[model samples]
Target: MFHMNRIFRHSHLTPYEADYAQWCAEQGALLREGRLSDLDRENLAEEIESLGRSDKREIESRLKVLLVHLLKLQFQAKQVKEGWRSTVVEQRRRIRKLIKESPSLRSYPMQVLAEEYEYARSDAAGETGLPARVFPENCPYDIDDILDLDFYPQAVGSAGGQSDLA
Candidate 1:
């Protein structure tokens, strides 16, 4: 049970927070019966925004997973495992599905690709046991190449990359 004594916060809980199932039923009835004025507009709007945020998070998370494996595939080619390819394929498919669902977010992946690469670089380095410098400072692959299911760099890692770790 939620504590009502917590000060500075709302002393009262709305139907949405206090009893979600009942609130949903009420809202559904309001919508179905064409009772627009009786609907919880504010909560509905917030729920819509929350769904968009959830989709964005899903795409970005999948992109991060793709980046990590792609970095491994590009920087530590000799150490590549079948599991990495499987992960790459899965993440790409999932990311593409999210973008397809929300066309407005089509450019979102490219916009945040570099930022996601930073996380990938760190994770790849740790996973591959190679220094972060072994990978490019910025994302070397573009959105299209990353998304391409057939794309996999044949060339090996950086020159003198000390591949002993891989």
Candidate 2:
């Protein structure tokens, strides 16, 4: 009986920290019971906001990965095309799907494009083992080009109408 009492007492001290699922259940019960005063309003608000922020972060992260692969396609030799092409297609699909679902986030990717590309530029350089100087200082491919299924950027010297980009 003493041990059970101690366990119950300890859990109450930091119920949210000790077991998050239990805390969530308790919070839900409070809400359902209309016990507004008992609800953990502060943490509840934080968690709700966190969900939105996480989706944006995921988009930004995928943008970076997509940029890196596109750079590899443009600057590196044709040998790696198959692997990089697959990644580019997948990222585009995912990004487009995310924006479609959220609707509110339609413009978010373009807003963060320039900033995220800088990170992607560094990543591409590291992955390709070529000087960063080889790649353009700014993103050569725009969001439309990046997301287009048929767009495959040609190298600067490639024999094409768009030697600069697709």
Best by lDDT: 2
TM-score of 1: 0.79
Tens-digit per-residue lDDT, 43-66, candidate 2: 888888998888899899999999
lDDT of 1 by residue, 1-166 (tens): 2233222222233478888765666666667657677668999889878999998888888998898988887777776787988998899888888888889999998988988989988988999999999888988888998898877654363565433323
Residue 129 C-alpha lDDT in model 2: 89
Which residue pairs come into collision in candidate 1? none
- Kindly report the root-mean-square deviation of model 1 from the true structure over all alpha carbons: 7.8
What C-alpha lDDT, on a 0 to 100 scale, does residue 122 get in candidate 2?
A: 97
Q: Which stretches of candidate 1 lie over 4 Å from their true place?
A: 1-14, 155-166
lDDT for each candidate structure = 0.78, 0.79
Measured by TM-score, the strongest candidate is: 2
